[model samples]
Target: MSLVWGFLALLYVSTDGLEPVPVALLAAFFTIFGAGMNVRLERSLERKGEYRPSRKTLALAILAGAGFLAVLFTGVIPALSRPIIGSFYLGIAVAWATRLILLWRWEAKTKRRIYVEGTWVGSFYLVPPGPLQPAPA
Candidate 1:
């Protein structure tokens, strides 16, 4: 991941030459950094018996990663804004999908069903079903 980001950074410097889209570049860096953090977090969770990667996780990872790549390479409704797309959009998408994959893995490991009953304002998680909690004004 670091290597990939490094290559991109080098390429960016060579091509754009002092471009002003710092946020987008930072997002790409963040995505790479976040991947390492995710690995460490999952290991810690496993040690705590809070989460475990399963086949479902593999499926989700493949699905999310491939979906993003498909959008990226296949150019299906591709982001025409070239600068923002590769750096900002892909970075955010991959990072977010990583988070979701972790959450889903945790739920799969814990036998917890996490979902909304309607609004997240009231009681939402539907496991061990009970009366819905009163909604806030």
Candidate 2:
């Protein structure tokens, strides 16, 4: 997640002295990865009417993507090794971090429990516990 990327970026910066292109590119990719996970979680919350990221949040994401795209194509980064693109990447990092903070808040906000099944999940119990059995050992 973001923390992992942040650690790697710290390593990279220690060696590279904040090379903007690598820093921005790595952070941008991490943002994308985390965002996808955020969206899926948000959708699950939506089913229970517990949460939905505001339209303003989506706009911020779009703006972040557009900013990165602009920097990606403008030749400023490759030609000048500009720190400006680093600012764009910082925006992405901060936005993703904010989304994560909101997610923690939503966990408390959920009115009832819900469930999700991932790729390997075959079955699960939806209702409450019936009885407790002692451990075999």
Candidate 3:
């Protein structure tokens, strides 16, 4: 993750030496790919009855991060020329906070479900239902 952001930073700095839109497009593509992978992984785990972040939560995080960046770019926060330079860090913080809150909520829900189900193993593991068996003669 750091590496991707680092590469984006490098691209932004080198934009004057190259075409900016193309570089920006590539960065956007990579970001989308990473986000899609995260969503797919979360859903897959959720289907197994494991605790995972919800898609809505993930979307919220993305929106927050994007909003932070948009604010910085539009000069709403007035970071001066530093807006372009500092936007990535600010965006990262926003996204991290979003993800953390999402995970917390997901864990809380999982705990509640476990309690309601009366499971002995707590919330970490999910067991599928099976038919009862009779003793052999």
Candidate 4:
């Protein structure tokens, strides 16, 4: 999901000639989309005592949102060109890429086996397989 978002963001930032306001709006939408999916995944993990993003992670998200809010409300971005806004989208793409790597590494280290309903971000668990019970596909 993050990879998809990152790719789309990069494509938009690099190829599109959208104004700063539209770029920022797209950024906001993508942020919400990814964050909501992440939150849903995290809550599922929390319910199963499997995982939770740390306070520092939450703080970083908050700070990023604040930065976007500043740009949205302050009218500073309107003066800037697409390159600047593109840079912001690029930053978001980078962040999502970093998050993907981290989540992959974390999953490897934790030895967790997640089972999702529809997608990787869907509700999942870490239950161990036992006798007479095959592992999830």
Candidate 5:
């Protein structure tokens, strides 16, 4: 999902060329969707005592989003002409597919562990732990 959104973002960068506002909007949508999916996956993992992203990882994601916006606004990527939007989408699709395949393979190779605790009131409150732990009590 992250890779898919990133591919779309790259396509936007390389194609008919979204204006800053549209690009920013797309970025926000992708970021929110990606974060939501991460939350869902983390919850699923918690049920099995398996993988979750750390605070450092979330912080890095925030930093990366900021940097991506800065680079876009700074014109680090050249403006794309309208003639090649199809090719841009094609390229992005290929890149996204390849990335997804690779990530699937990598994940298959390594097992990850996750631990989560929650307090229930009117609403559920999730509390994720730090990266390291002594042991499960």
Candidate 6:
């Protein structure tokens, strides 16, 4: 991750414009630094052994990351006007909405099991069912 950050920093700083390089370098450097932070976060989560995302959710996350990288590399965010940037953000919002719906459905359908006191508990819902309402009095 640091190597990737170094490469990006080198490329960005080597560009012709020196005036904004300092500010852009700081921003991009920290943003790239987040890749390393994400690794640390994933490791800590794995160690906890209590949280696991569904395969579908993981795949969607990968796709979303790839899509965002594609958008950035295509220069859509930098080259476009404000409305285009807004549209890009609008698309992200739509994607997030779809992801939320899919995640909720997946959670509602999937069951997880954990062992406690040498016995297995097989009923776990990521999205637990809502409380039942009494019949109309």
User: Which candidate number maximizes TM-score?
Assistant: 4
- Candidate 6: residue 16 lDDT (0-100): 25
lDDT of 3 by residue, 6-125 (tens): 457455544434444554555465555545544554465477755445567667757875785586557665333443445455334344345445545655555422111212211333
The best-first sequence of candidates by TM-score reads 4, 1, 2, 5, 3, 6
Instruction: Report backbone clashes per prediction.
Output: 0, 0, 0, 0, 2, 0
User: Model 4 — which ten-residue stretch has the worst lDDT?
Assistant: 115-124
Query: Could you give candidate 6's per-residue lDDT for residues 4-107 as a string of tens digits?
Result: 43345345433423334344444454444544433443353335634444567657756875786576557666532323222333333333344345434443
C-alpha TM-scores of all predictions: 0.36, 0.36, 0.31, 0.41, 0.33, 0.27
lDDT of each: 0.51, 0.51, 0.47, 0.57, 0.46, 0.40
lDDT: which candidate is best?
4
Predicted candidate 5 versus true structure: per-residue lDDT over 51-86, tens digit per residue: 445667667766866775576657666655332222
Clashing pairs in 4: none
Superior by lDDT: candidate 2 or candidate 5: 2
Judge candidate 3 against the unseen true structure and give its global Cα lDDT, from 0 to 1.
0.47
The candidate with the higher TM-score, 1 or 4, is: 4
Q: Model 2, 40-89: lDDT tens per residue?
A: 66675565543444567667856865676576556556644544344444
Pairs that clash in candidate 1: none
User: Candidate 4 residues 29-64, lDDT tens each?
Assistant: 656665655555656675775554456766786687
Clashes of 6: 0
Full-model lDDT, candidate 1: 0.51
Model 2 residue 132 CA deviation in Å: 13
